[model samples]
Target: MSKALSKRFGEESMDRIITWLEMQKISKDVALLDIGTGNGVFLIELAKSGFTNLTGIDNSSTAVELAKAIAEKEEVMSLKLQVADFLHPFPKLSQYDICIDKGTFDAISLSPDHPAEKRSLYQQSLHSVLKEGGMFLITSCNWTKEELVNHFSEGFEMLQELPTPKFQFGGKIGNSVTALVFRRK
Candidate 1:
């Protein structure tokens, strides 16, 4: 997962997304969850930026262990790393102010298995752990702006669309990766 993530999302892509998140002025008191947070890279960055309440969950046990090690080495005292699957039910008390997914959605969508059912459950799980009006930030290379917005229309309101600046063949505007925020309603 870590290697795949690194290959899919470059430093520049992460920098842009982080910059946009910083612009949101998220309060330190608010809970933040990073779904599929492999190695806690984004959580470490958030910790460095003074966000104290952070949680990262990944389905892979190895990824969770790596994230824990990274968090400890970086002295991210407030981060809680867990091994959990988004397709299953989360605890009732697990509510968050914000939830982020960098590439998990794309992976689920591209998998050969029951992608639609798993995707639906994943969205529901996100909503279950997110407070009303809480934000869900997703960065995906598999979905376009319209596809994502439409896909999330059932339970979330599209808040914003952020596109990566990579220029494809003929100087076209859009890139493989697209970033978007949706507010739970």
Candidate 2:
């Protein structure tokens, strides 16, 4: 499980999120949502870490099915996995206290079909599903910290920026990925 998560989402990514959760003193019983949960590995990890109320959603039915299978195989069947598009109105689910997104915003930003509209809709959908003052943690390889802040500035405020690997190129150092936590306003 660790190897699969490390290969798909760098080990550091998950570690940093867990660290932040601890730093924030988030309760294990908080209603947490995993946005764009691909295979449900992260949800399983959260379950193993003692998070009780876990829900994951992906636009692809196949991905949701895969997540369900993986969760069952790992004996973490308490998770709620469903197919829901973030750019559209989400299905009726309870508002979450915390939401995590890994690479979903990056994919939406790259969409050629009305990228601006999709991005706006994504924010709206997220806002609709997350409670006021809810925390949103996102990890992206396609955008810088500054870019992400600018994108989500309207209804969200930056809380913390997680450290990522840096590379030096032409005497300039930059991060390969940006992980940010925001609070819904």
Candidate 3:
């Protein structure tokens, strides 16, 4: 599964995230939330890296169940996996020190059911769940860095833009993915 994830989302992406966490001196026990955690591979990797307090939430119940099963098979007992929509506030969950989104924002942006409204709700819900001054690391394929910064400008300030693979197309240089780290205001 890890190998498959590495193939789907380059292994370097996960390495970069772990590296950034270490460079920022984020504690292993800090409350961390993985938004739209598909199969929980990322959380499992974090667990392997020694992050103890981790929670992963996905909108799909089946995804949550798969994550739970994978975590169990991997002997990762510390992960808390649940099915919850990121467009809504999670009343039962505590505010997290860090939140990571790989493709949730992009998916919401592409939804045909009131995309603009859903995007707004996503921001509100994310703000509610993430602590002030907390970190949000997001990786997106649909939006450029500037677009992402603009979308999150309301309550998040750009901290750093992580490196991703680039290509030349139509006499222009573009990145296949944009990974940005933002700090909640």
* Predicted candidate 3 versus true structure: per-residue lDDT over 135-160, tens digit per residue: 99998878999999999999999999
List residue ranges in candidate 1 displaced over 4 A. 1-10, 170-172
Best-fitting candidate, scored by TM-score: 3
Off by over 4 Å in 2: 1-8
TM-score of each: 0.90, 0.93, 0.94
CA error at residue 47 for candidate 3, angstroms = 0.3
List of clashing residue pairs for candidate 2:
none
Per-residue accuracy of model 2 over 92-123 as CA lDDT, tens digit each: 75489999998888889889999899889888
Off by over 4 Å in 3: 1-6
Residue 60, model 3: lDDT of 97
User: Which ten contiguous residues of candidate 3 have the minimum total lDDT?
Assistant: 1-10
- Pairs of residues at least 3 apart in sequence or in different chains that clash in candidate 1: none
* Root-mean-square deviation (CA) per prediction: 2.4, 2.7, 2.4
Range of the 10 consecutive residues with the lowest summed lDDT in candidate 1: 5-14
Model 2 compared with the native: what TM-score? 0.93
Q: On a 0 to 100 scale, what is the lDDT of residue 53 in model 2? A: 95
> What overall lDDT goes with each candidate model?
0.82, 0.88, 0.90
